[model samples]
Each structure stands twice: as structure tokens, then as C-alpha cells.
Target: MNEVQARQAIVDAGTVLYKQGYVVSNDGNISVRISPDTIVVTPTGVSKGDMNPDMMVVMNLDGNVISKGLRGPSSEVKMHLRVYRENPDVTAVVHAHPIYATSFAIAGVPLDKPILSEAMLQVGVVPVAHYAKPGTTDVPDSIAPFVKDYAAVMLSNHGVLTWGSDLEQALARMEVVENYAKVTLVVNQIGSERGLSQDQVDGLAGIRQNMGLSPIVMPKGNAEVINGTDVIPQGN
Candidate 1:
């Protein structure tokens, strides 16, 4: 997308994230790579819902400001830059604090179960990165291991981070993470959480590969058979 289009898209996406209750106050960040060397990002300290196209900041891949907006870039811009550095194909990055997904992050859990087909296709397993103080270089360092392999990662005690080839896809993946978290929460509350069988998960992986997606690294030994009766209730 051109610079004008990229700026407007960022505003639209920020509005969507706010309206969906994925972010509150000034709690999230969104960015789009407008060129190999530059990105358009949400300004810090503004409610995402209140953002306008003019509020978007432009910065280089090196995190240097190309043009200041109505305000400065988000403090978490380094994490976005890290994703771009790790994977050139990622043109957009979204970070948000959706309740369910953030709850999992706070609890140090990973959304790795292959229970929902759409979740599997859209996001696969969302692993948790090590806890790092928000807005620190540690945030980028924490996620470095998973950026190249996964579309999304849960920041410990923070929120979800998702990336894709474009803003729409990145935003969609964020929604999927929250939805999957909701389902996983309900399953745990119900005392029965049966995952898709190994064959079923493998089939979906095949479909993912056929669609030109990268391989999902499932947790070691997570492919074991899990019948409904075999699950132990995880009390909230």
C-alpha cells in the first residue's frame, strides 16, 4: 500500500481494535511496513479509537523517526521492528490487550490446543514469550525466538502480538487469538478439553502448508490422544 493508504489503514485498524474492546485507553500498538526501510505506526498516548490518519508516525526499520505525527510513535515500536527484521514477509504488526488473550498471558499459558479449525487455520498455536518489562528492549528479545515461526505470540503478563503480510490479516489474526482464548477458557471451565486428534491436526497442518503457510511448531508430545474423560478440570 502507498503511504496515504497505509496511514488510513492504520487508523481504521486502531478503531477496529478499540471498538472490539481489544484495547483500552492507550494500551496497544499497530503498524504497517510501507516500504522495506520505513513503517507507519500508531502514535503513543492516544486512545486507539480516537486516532486519525494524521496521528500516524513514520519511522525507518532502524527505529529512527522519518516524520513525527501529532505525537510520537508507540513505545513498543521495537517489538514491531523486531518482527520485520526477523521476517521480511510481515508487512503489518498488531499488539492488543483483549481480555481473554491477555488473561492467558498473565497466567503464563500458551494457546496451543488444536481444538478449533478456524483458529488452527488462521493462527495455529500461540506460544508465550518470556516475561519482559513492557516498552523495554527485553520485549523484543523475549519474542525473538518465535517471530520467524509463528504468526502470533502472547507476551507474558502483557498482551497478544500478531503479524501478517498486511494490516487486515494482522488484525484478523489478533481477533482469532482472542476468540481462541475465549474457547479455551470455556473448555477449561467446563472440565472437558479434548483436543483434535493427531491425524486431524496433521491434516490441518497439511492444508496450512498447501496454502503457503509456514509450519507450526506444536509443543513436544502435545499430539497425544486426549479423550474428553481424560482431561482434568482446571479450576479458574
Candidate 2:
């Protein structure tokens, strides 16, 4: 992609994620693959709502800084860099802490349940990685195994990781994660946490695979829906 295009993609991602309530303040980071070894990512400590194209940082796959200005690389650049190295098919990555999805992480529960047909189709069963210190090797390594198969994984005791062939596709997947979590949360609150039927869930998976969306395996058996309320058990 052209430099202008790459830069705008990051800027646009910030605005969209922020507006969608997927990310608040400057809690998330976004990046696009500019080259095989170079990734253009948002800088640290910047509010997503007003991030400018010029503030994004360009870094190598090793997380080495190639460019720096008013904005510095995000402290979590390592998380983004490791993804680029391990998943060649991924062209963009988004890290966000939307409350609903993040609720699973904070609860120390893996989102392995396939409650939503659309989630199965769109994201499959989101896995939970073991807890690791943020901005460290632990977090990336935790997500490595599922990167090839699952487009999104919940960071244990942390947040969420979602990626795609491009920034828009990546961001769209994140939106699904956010919306699904929101719906799931709300459903749980009213004392109804029942997931879809096995046949219905499978149907959505089939549709997703045919549509070229992420291929996620629909977990068999009944799912315990946690609506928008806290899905994770107490003291998790």
C-alpha cells in the first residue's frame, strides 16, 4: 500500500475503534503491515479519537524503531511485532480492551464457548492465553499458537487480540468481538444465557467459511451464555 494509504488506515482505525466503544481513551493500539519487515503502528500515549496520521511509528518486525518523532513507539509494540513475525498472513493487528470481551479475560476464563452463531462464523471460539506480563515476550508467545487458526484470542488477565489480511478487515473482526461480547453480556444479565442450537451454530460456521471469513471451529455441545453480565465465575 502507498504511504498515504498505510498512514490513513491507522488513523482511521483509531477513530473507528474509539467511536464504536471498542476502545476508550487511548487504551488500544493498531498497526498495518507496510512491508515484509516493517509495520506502521500507532504511537504511545495518544488518544485514539484524535490520533493524526503523522504520529504513527514505523518499526521492523523485530520491534526495532525505524522512525520516531513527536510520538514514540507504543510500549506494547512487542505484542504487535511478534504477531507480524509469527503470522505471515496477517497484515494488520488490533489490541483493544472493550469491557464485554475483556470481562472474560479479567475473569480468567477462556472464551471457548460458541454461544453466538455469528461469533462462530466470524471469530469461532475465542481462546484464552495464559497470563503474561504486558509488553513482554509472555503475551506474544501466549497468542502464537492460535494465531494461525483463530483470528482473535483473549489475553489472559489482559485484553484481546484480533487481526486480519488488512486493517479494515482486522478492525471489523474486532467490532464483532465487541458487539458479541456486548450482546452476550446483556443476555447473561436477564437470567438467560442459553447459546444457539448445535445445528444453528454449525450453519453460521458454514456460512463464515464460505464467505472467506476466519475459519473458526464451532465448539460442539451446549454453551452457557453469559449475556453482557459477568460470564467469568466469581473470584476467577
RMSD of each: 4.9, 7.1
Overlapping backbone residue pairs in candidate 1 total 0
Q: Please provide, for model 2 over 1-236, each residue's C-alpha lDDT reduced to its tens digit, 9 standing for 90 to 100.
A: 75669888888888887887767776889999988988888889888888888888887897778888447887877778878888898999999888888887788765555566666666777778888997778877888888888878888766888988888878888878777777766776887556665666667777876887666655674543334445566784
Best by lDDT: 1
Please give the distance, in angstroms, between residue 191's alpha carbon in candidate 1 and its true position after superposition. 0.9
Q: List model 1 lDDT by residue over 1-236, tens digit each.
A: 98899999988998899999999889899999988989999989999999889888999999999899987888899999999999999999999999999999999989987788789888888999999987789999999899888889999999999999899999999999999999999998899756777877777788989999878664332466765656678779
The true-versus-predicted C-alpha distance at residue 18 of model 2, in Å, is: 1.8
TM-score of structure candidate 1 = 0.92
Error of 2 at 157 (Å): 2.8
Which pairs of residues clash in candidate 2, taking residues 3 or more apart in a chain or in different chains?
184-227, 184-228, 185-227, 185-228, 185-229, 186-227, 186-228, 188-227
lDDT of each: 0.89, 0.78
Q: Candidate 2: where are CA atoms >4 Å away?
A: 221-236
lDDT of 2 at 32: 90
